[model samples]
Target chain A: MKKTLVILFVIIGFNAFSQTANQILLNTYNKFSKVKTFKNKVHVDFNIPSINIDTITGKSYYKAPLKFKFKFKGIAFLPKDNPFLIYNFIKDSTKYIAVLNGTEKVQKQNCIIINVIPKEEGDVMMAKFWINPNTNCPLKMQITSKSNGVILIENFYGKYANLCLPDKTIFTIDMKKFKVPKMVSADINSKSTKSKDSSTKTIGTIIFNFSNYIVNTVINDKIFTDK
Target chain B: MWQLTKIELFKIFSKPRSYIGFSAVTAIAIVIQIALYADGKSYWDFLIQSLDESFQIENLTFNGNMVCFILLQALIVQMPLLVALVSGDAISGEAAAGTIRSLLTKPVSRSKILWAKLLANEIYTFLLVLWLGILAWVVSLAIFGSGDLVVLKSDSLTIIRGADSAWRFIAAFGIAFLSLSVVVTLALLLSVFSENSIAPIIITMSVIILFTIIGTFDLPVFNQLKPFLFTTHMIIWRNLFDNPLPTEQIFVSIGVLVLHIVLFLAITFYHFKRKDITQ
Candidate 1:
């Protein structure tokens, strides 16, 4: 009887934590779901060790759900992932199980950390979020996907915090960690070799600053269709 | 001095061999442009294939700027040989044809005659580089249109905007003129010693090839010798395309090339003044 009582307490405590995580995600989702569409002017600054590109200005378009596209004036090296797709994943609680990890300080705010794993097999394998419980805004995110590997994003909200939209977003990509075809085959003697070429993996950061955001506006589906 | 140089220029143009440099440069530039036009996309795909997995590289267009850069790299290597063909034959060909004795017997001093020939050779080298500039830069722009230049080295890739590229091209051509001028003086110096036109031309080419080989490999012994090689400095023009241009390195290369021109001219003048021409 004592052992059964102990087991019952453990189940109740675990359920409480899971419910708390679920409630936090639901509030964050509700904050963002109000926007049916948005058109924003984006200014991107690329900071990569290997690449030499500086700043490029573009327009970012978003429709209901997860459609996002960027149109830059010239050649740009950028991430392929849809930036808004993370919200889509979290909003549907049936698709993923969220566990409250703990609290961590992000952008001077004590943010709640939640780890999410998809209940079904899909492109997204796992995701983690650092959410500001007070504002229901995601201050930081780590998304692991089948196509893009591990992408770490930090969102800084200002005038758009009420809508849970970031005024600035920093996307960091580690090229070597991608689960894609390798650039070159590893040399047979690479293990013992002291000399190596400089073409090895490196980190690339793309900082996107958004302004003149027109939300809940009409967006034609033509731009979202792949050419 | 200008009149003497004009006569020497006339002599250079009269020879059929002088046209070879101009013709070769034009033909090679056009051929490269044609090949690129037909299927440059595949070539670009292969070059950026490694980076594609990590980046969605938007608007890497194959345009005039890229074509011109490619042409410059290809044509610059063979330009010295073309220059050597004309400047190499300046004195030795006159000697081989028994015209040097008559040419020397003219009222001009040996120093004045040599200087005139040097001036003419310099002019020819300048025109050839200019012709390459026209075909490689101006013509390619006409054919392919304009866009940013994406230069892919062994380990790095640089994207130079179309707006910022004009000055770099002009600077590279100016440097190419300086580089080819070194070949002119070296060939003339060799000409002063040889009785036949072919020897100086052949010897100058051999030296260029030898130095190029030494500069290419980074062996410990060769590293010590690289700074002295004109071939090593000839590639300094490429630094213009780099972000945060290495101004010091460019100046050092220009200084080295100018020194080579002075040294070769001094030896050619000294040897020609005392030579027994009656033989």
Candidate 2:
């Protein structure tokens, strides 16, 4: 009778800790979703080791519920979907299972690590978030997707700590594993006769430094539409 | 010899057909420039789609050097036809007009007249290429302005600075001239076997088209045979744009093209020297 009681208490303790971890994740998601809109002056730097590409800069405007506009002075390349999609996924608990893995220190701050597994079949297979326990903000996120490979993002929060906004975001991508159309790759291969081996294994990194961010600004929806 | 060449040049320039090549080149260049100017952004987007996820390229200008490179790639394929039009008619046209008999009746040897005709044809080929350069490269600079040249190949994207690009263009054009020389020689050799000017022109074009098809066919048998085709060497000019230019391969391609030209000219000389004019 004594042994049975001890085992039951241990099981209850494990369940209670798991519930507390889920509650913490929910709080962090709510804090990030509070920002309605923002406009930022951004400078993007790219470092592609295999293919020599220089750094680039641009301006970004973002609104709540998936509105993002990026304008560059000249030719620019970006992913098809907005970067903020990760945040949107976190805010909604219906489509994903978020579990608290453990705790770690990021930049001398104690952080709670959460592993998010999508419920429905999608491009993103898994996403791991490292959240600062004090501010309920994300310090780093590593997303592994089915088509685009792995994307590791590290966020730096400065004076916008209260608003839960990042001053800089660094993205490192595994380009070789990214799923592009076979036709595009074939076309490029046919024309290029050099560096055939190196191009297939390229890894690229992009750093975005955000400045003069105006949070909760009223932005027209027309600005996000393609001209 | 100079007088014979001059007469050949005069005969070539007097015909209205000579201007056709120049006019075609100019029109094609202008049309392409206009098209690119109007809808270049969509083309740019299509090209950079693979790199879009990683890089944010900005301030990339569609400058004259880049335009010239594009024009050269598009125009090189049609240049053989232009070369064949004039050189193919050099001997056969004279035969059709009964001028060969009159010219052979003179004290000069048949080989000398052949050499003069070949020299005149070479000069004409040079002028045609120069005119193409003026319209495609020089005029494009006037319109689009000068900047770094961006060359997109199947596997690589190369950007050549404005200061460094001129010498590469010069080398490319020189290599292009050598390639065209092979076409001219082949046409001239074909001209010797026919009495009708149209027949030689058509035959030369047919041979080029056939060879090009064989060279570009992506089959094991064709790939093995491609090295023997003179048409395969014609695109050796593209090597100029490659970083750390493959000097040995470029030289080999040049050697092959030159060998083809020499063989064609030698065969023409051997047959012409032995043929009886009276028959």
Candidate 3:
């Protein structure tokens, strides 16, 4: 009779802790989910070893669910994973299991770290988010996806904190297969690429900064589809 | 010495071989431009295929600057051969014709004669490089219009602005001129050794081919030897287009080419001064 009582108590405590985790995640996701559509001027600063690219600025559009597009004048190196995909996954409680992994301070803000495991197998195998409980805004996210091995992102929020819009989101990606193409040039003395190691990967970073947010506004669907 | 150089210049231009480099450069440049005009977009698509998944690339075009850059790359390799033809025959041609004996008996010092010949060969090489520049860059601009120059390496590609390419092209051609001059000096040195003109030209080409082959491979032994080869520095002209241009490397290549020219000239002068003239 004593052992049965202890087991029952243990199950109740575990269920309570899980419910609290779900509440925290839901609260955080709700902060940013209010907007049906948003358009903002995005400035991109990219860095990758062996790649030389200039700073580019453009307009970024986001529609509810999963519709994001960058309309830039020139070329840009963007991360493979959608930045807002985690929001949709977090909002849909049935698609994933969110567990409270206790609290830790990230950049002096006390954050509640949650370990997310997707119920269904997809691009995102596992993800961890550090959300500031005070503001209900995410401070950092580390996602491991199928295509890109490991992506670490740091989010910084300023005036847009109420809307959960980040002033800047820095993404550090270690791409396993950012393949460099080889063309058959007519030059006779061109070196053979036999020496280049294909197995080795490179780390690249993209700093996405946003300002002048016009949220809950009607954005043309053509902006996403237009080439 | 100036008058003698002028006479040597006359001799060079009078030969049918002198026009070969110019005509060949013109024909090759035009052919490459035509091919690019027909189907360059596909080539670009192939090059950026790997990056397509990660990037939304826009405003990319195969413009005149790119065509010129491609022409320069293709032609630089063969420029040395064209230059070697005339330069190798400068001394040995006279010997083969039995004019070298009587010419050496003149009142002028052997050093002056060698200088005059070297000066004449340098002029011919300069003209060839100029011809290449006109056909590759100037004419290309006239045909295709101007845009960014996209330079591709074995593993990477750099996009240089259209406005910025003019200085880089000029600097590249200047370095290219210096590089070809090294070939002229080397051929002249070989010419000093052989009595027959054909031998020197063939030998100079053989050396260039051998070094280029070694540089093309990635073997341990070849890598060790690459830094010492003149051919290793020959392509450094492309460095002008590299972002954060490798200034020290460019200077080193220029210095090495200059040293080679001076050393080869000294040796040629020394050997020819004491050489026995017999037909």
Candidate 4:
């Protein structure tokens, strides 16, 4: 009778552990997937020797899978591309969620890993998320997009709480993809050819840190619409 | 002394050629305005669209904002040449015309005559600049209609609110006048050395263009010399666009300009006093 009781106890403990792990993965992803609903500040750093842009600052805000806004301070947008700070490019039939290949690693006392890929080919290419195994919360993410290029984002440095959102976050850009359309203009192109051997490039750097972010706050609807 | 100077001033203004500078300013302002109006939207839209992916901006109301700023942008590189056309030729043109000989024969010292010419040229320059401010900014705003001022720098876009732009425009022109005056004064000094009006005008413009190229080249040699170049000081007007005034740099520019004025005027007077006037 005692042996039978031990076997039943072992089975229940195994089931509980399985449920917890799945719950942690799902909860962390859900919180991160809702990124567009929050107000956050981001810092973009870029360097390109060809066109000579080193670094600059810009802010990002999002409404959902379809609508997003980016505001670059002191930088003007070129005419060929869309210039809205918040862009809504999601189509009606587009998928919003997908499970990507996951990688595992131990961070401090907690073990966590994540895998994610874009639902569309034209959307951001790769996004890797790091979740705390014990707390079931996402702690950081590394993202790369074809449009803006590579970006690194991490939550505010603090102990992760179970199934809770980050209080503060920081976003950074890799600078390779930050391009100005005017750099490709005919005037610059001709000048480039003339001084093909003489031109020397300067690199610029910019860094930004975000604090006191409030998620699910009331954002104006007009921010997403065209004038 | 003042009376004689006033007569010379009157003579300069009474000539139809004096009005040419003002007329040219008006003509250029109108041409640029028309060109901007025709394609201003597309130009603005193109700029906004380029970085839209990074910064998803929406509902940027043009309402003549971008056009007003474009006018100012054009002036930064163009207005000094206009200033040189008149102020640079003040003494040189008179010498080339053989009018200086007749005027010098009057009951006046060479120094006094030089002062009169300088004063007259300065007055003309100030008036021309004021006229330009009115036509380029005020009249254009009226014709184009008032709105925000959208400024485009290398990597950023700055918007000055419409309500804030009026005073900003006034301040910008005020700073622009000070800068142009320095150019005018330098041209006046050059005019003293040349026999032909065109030569002084051309030389002054060449000097400015050369310095502008040097300032922008990013060479280690130029980086050291940039602070000393008058062209570097010429763009002091642009600093007013910053949220807070860059007072120290502005003061430095003022000091540099004042020093140039004094040095140029001193040289002009010394040269004029000893000049044989035989030619």
Candidate 5:
């Protein structure tokens, strides 16, 4: 009878732990969703070993339900979809199978790791999030996609920790893995032998530094429209 | 030879058809510049949509340098037709006008006359490219102002600083002139075969169109054949924008183009030299 009681208690404890991990993810998502509008100054640094480029600085405006506009003076190279993917995933939590992968230290802070597998087939095949247990914020995220390969993003929080907004985000992408069909690659095929050799070893990284975040600011939808 | 070439140039410039190339270039450049000035932001946004999520661009100006690059891309394809219009008619048009017989009756050898015509065609090709450069690059700069040049290729995006891009444009135009010379020579060769100006022009354009199609077609069969096509080498001007600037490849492309020019010239010379003008 005592053995049977212990077994029941153990099962309850396991279920409780599972629920706690899921609750943490929900809390993080909820915290991030609260900011309806935000305007911030951003500085971008592209660290591409194969190419040379200067730092790009710009102003970015974001509105809830996916309206984003960036105003800049110079050319900037960036991944088009991953930022939205991160926001979309957090906004719609029901589409993913989130499971606790246990605890780990992220940036020397204790965090709970969650393995998220998409329920429906989409661009994102799977994603892993390292959530700061105390603040219920994502410290780091690794997303794997069929088309875009793997994207690793590290988030650095500042005064807006409570709001789940990062002051900076660093994105790393393996450029060599990105397959561009010959039809689309401009005139690279004119020097195909040389280009083929160099493309295999290239890696691209982009860093976003955000400041002066004015949250809940009124921004017109027309500003986001392509002019 | 110099006197003969001079006479040929005078004859070419005297014709009203010679002005068409210059007019077309200017019209196209102005139209494109105006359109870009009016609605370029929306067009650029669509192009950069894929990269927008990660990078925030700033101070993205549409200046003369950018316009020049765009003009080159849009106009290079059409430039061959302009070249063919004059060059394809070099011999055939003379024949059709009954001037070839009188010219052959002179003390000058057929080979020397052919050289003079080719030399005159080369000078015309050089002037046409220079006119395109002055109008497209220099005039656009005057209108739009100067800024960095951003080039978007299939697999990569290259941004060249405003100050550094001038030399690249010069080199690109130089290479473009060489490629156009190949077209001129090809047309002249075809001109040797016919007495009608229209036939040579049509034949030159047809050959170029066919080769370009074969060069661009993604089929496995076409892939092997692409390396051999002069049309494939024609776009090597774009290579100057590549980060490392594939020097060897550019040289090879130039070598191949020069080879095509030589071959075309040789055949035209051979056919003209042995021809019976009396018949």
Candidate 6:
């Protein structure tokens, strides 16, 4: 009878362990939902072969759901959950239809591969992703846009374990042909990498340091409702 | 000389294309200002938030009104290019248009005609700069209301009071005009080498872009070269936004830019006079 009881408890414990992974993710996401306001610092580094662009240090603030503000030095670029992004996503949702490519392990985490045909026809090519089964996160994002062309964004899970956020994200993009407006005021000029030729074979690296991780801080009431 | 200059000025203002650049300036400024205004709160919050991390202080308020400041910031970088578009063409376009030969028939020396064109271009550039100042400052304040001018640079944030903004703009505009005049001179010099006005404009702008890219390379080689670049001087107008205005560096930038103008004009005059205009 004792042996039977032990076997039942073991089976129950394995089932509970398997269930906790999804449960933990849901809880973390729920905590995120409860977070009304918080602030964090970001150090953005662009790596190009020939350019040693200056490091941009900035702060980011979010007030739930759709509002995200990024202040770099003193100028600001805000990308929020406006209708534009939502509408574009909704409209392009059909375009994201993918043909099964193949499977590969991204940072030892298994991911499904799919090729996407971008709804908007341009130099940029598109690829799609369905999350890896082991880690319920974005497995792959690839674009074929040249200059504004195809880029691939893939996330690895090893860095921030149980963080519910993708740990290591890599963006593979073609820089030589990327075309942005000459006058769009962003840090474009400051982020170019140096080119290496026969005369110069040296590659340069820039390290960005970020600290002071404050989470779930109380925010002013007006910030969320002001705009 | 005065009569010749008046004639040249007349020719410039009468052309329909002269107004296109101005229209573009106003249209672009208005579009961007409106876009920024519609999306300002989040923008301001982002700026403030970025500043919040490096800065220990709390409740940092932009003493300057947001709209006016954004207008000025936009103008500072772009005005020079717009000014260059017209000013660069004043000499080269005249040459390309085959009007230089008729103008030269007035018994005035080629050098004198060149000088008149240069003077006319400077006046036109100054006027454009003034227009930008008025449109950016007066119109912006009218639309957005008056406050302090807060300028954010890579390393620091500058705050200028509402009362002091006008004079600072005047100084800034002066510097901007002077910097563009150098581009004008460079384009005119390129004009002497080529009959195609568009080619000179393209070449001049390319040179400016190349130099600007080089200036930002942040290499030991570029560090020495940065001080000499006219593009470096172009932004010196921003010093007025600085609380303790870096006057020495501003003057030095102005002097170097003026020297470049002199050198370019001299070269253009020499080349224009020596070239056989038989074609």
The number of the candidate with the highest lDDT is 1
Q: Rank the candidates by lDDT, best first.
A: 1, 3, 5, 2, 4, 6
Candidate 3, B51-168: lDDT as tens digits: 6544445556678898999899889988999999899999999999888988888899999999999999988888888888888999889988888777776566677767788999
Clash pairs detected, candidate 2: A75-B57, A188-B154, A191-B154, A192-B154, A192-B155
| CAPRI grade, predicted model 6 | incorrect
The candidate, 2 or 4, that scores higher on lDDT is 2
lDDT, candidate 6, B1-279, per-residue tens: 888778778877887767776887798778967776677656665654532322222223433244655666666566656656766677668768887677678777888888888777777777787777777767766766665555554323455545667788777777778888888788778877877768877788788888878865778888788888888877777677666777898889889999998899888988898987753
Candidate 2 ranges with C-alpha deviation above 4 Å: A1-150, A153-171, A174-227, B154-156
Task: Mark the regions of model 4 whose C-alpha exceeds 4 Å error after superposition.
Answer: A1-22, A28-111, A117-126, A133-136, A143-151, A157-167, A174-227, B1-6, B44-50, B58-69, B92-113, B139-175, B193-229, B235-253, B276-279
Give the DockQ (2 decimals) of all models: 0.33, 0.15, 0.25, 0.09, 0.20, 0.02
Q: How far is candidate 6 from the true structure (C-alpha RMSD, Å)?
A: 14.9
Q: Which is better, 2 or 5, measured by lDDT?
A: 5
- Per-candidate Cα lDDT values, in order, are 0.86, 0.79, 0.85, 0.60, 0.81, 0.59
Error of 5 at A97 (Å): 22
The best candidate by DockQ is: 1
Q: How far in Å is the alpha carbon of B136 misplaced in model 1? A: 1.7
- lDDT string, candidate 4, B23-53, tens digits: 7777777887887678766766676553444
lDDT of 1 by residue, B1-279 (tens): 889899999999999999999999989998999998997778777767757877788778889989999889888988999999998999999899989999898899999999999999999999999999999999989998898887656545678878889999999999999999999999999999998989999999999999987876657798799899998898888888888788998999999999999999999999999988864
Is 1 or 4 the stronger prediction by TM-score? Answer: 1
For candidate 5, give the lDDT of residue A71: 70
Worst 10 residues of 1 chain B by lDDT: B150-159
Model 3 residue A16 CA deviation in Å: 4.7
Deviating ranges (above 4 Å) for candidate 5: A1-74, A77-170, A173-204, A207-227
TM-score of chain B of 5: 0.96
State candidate 5's TM-score: 0.65
Q: What TM-score would you give candidate 6 relative to the actual structure? A: 0.53
- Chain B only: TM-score of model 6: 0.88
